[model samples]
Target: MRGTIHVLNGPNLNLLGEREPAIYGHDTLADVEAMCRAEADAAGYALEFRQTNAEHEMVDWIQAARKDAAGIVINPAAFSYAAYPVLDALKLCDCPIVEVHISNIHRREAEWRSKSIMTQVVTGIVSGLGVHGYALAVRHIAEVRGRTK
Candidate 1:
């Protein structure tokens, strides 16, 4: 099998470093993308980096991953707690899936943070570690790859 991964981001995350620096930290989205690409490469994996502010686009990408990739890492951002469409697409894929969040949703205000509709479909979730969550999720993906070895 090809050890490929698709990193998908959604809704306003393009403003990473500057968007609420207290919550999202100082790493820009491009900065994090570079980190993810390098980390995936180090883990012997190929990557497909994608980002969109539209929920439908993210859903479409996840649906496409069903036949096109080996693993998936998504930072659905505000959509995580509200995106049933994204969850629906994830449920269609058999590949290993991980969700990423730059902030700890559960610790935030009830209205500002909410439960993930897609959590049940993911093998694991990484959040609140800021940009490092991406690389850490990559390691977890590598570990899953390790087990199947």
Candidate 2:
């Protein structure tokens, strides 16, 4: 593997296609993973894809990425609001981190939806592109990792 990239998804993501077809699109989580894998593979990188509803589990994954991954792509869903612990764990990572959001949180009418704690630590973010955002994030990691290598 040229490098390893961890693609982590937050709560409700497993329900992807069935959750909100209008905003999030009709693609399932599996579809997103497949797309990410193809993107990483094309860039000569290995992929580690995971999704969890538990905050602690997500933190543990982030901690693991700090040592085992060349980069990370995270879609923290609900955790984006105020998961301080998750934010702290992400801060520990020395590699590039890209935050992805299927919906354009900024355009949401709800004021709270626009706020993302993960933004503080991520190298960049891909939002409003639906499931394609995940692919973009992985592609970004691959490019950055390639340059670093």
Among the numbered candidates, top TM-score falls to 2
> In candidate 2, where is summed lDDT lowest over 10 consecutive residues?
140-149
Scanning candidate 1 in windows of ten residues, the lowest lDDT window is: 105-114
Candidate 1 matches the true fold with a TM-score of: 0.92
Cα misplacement distance, residue 49 of candidate 2 (Å): 0.4
After superposing candidate 1, which stretches have Cα over 4 Å from the reference? Answer: none
CA-only RMSD, every prediction: 1.6, 0.7
Candidate 1 on 1-149: residue-level lDDT in tens? 34788899988988888888987888898998899888888888898888899998898888878875768999988788878988889888887899998887778878546588778899899978878998888777877876886
Question: For model 1, what is the error of residue 96's alpha carbon versus the real structure, in angstroms, after optimal superposition?
Answer: 0.9
Summarize candidate 2's per-residue lDDT along 9-87 as a digit string, tens digits.
9999999999868888899999999999999999999999999999999999999889769899999999999899999
Which portions of model 2 show Cα errors greater than 4 Å?
A: none
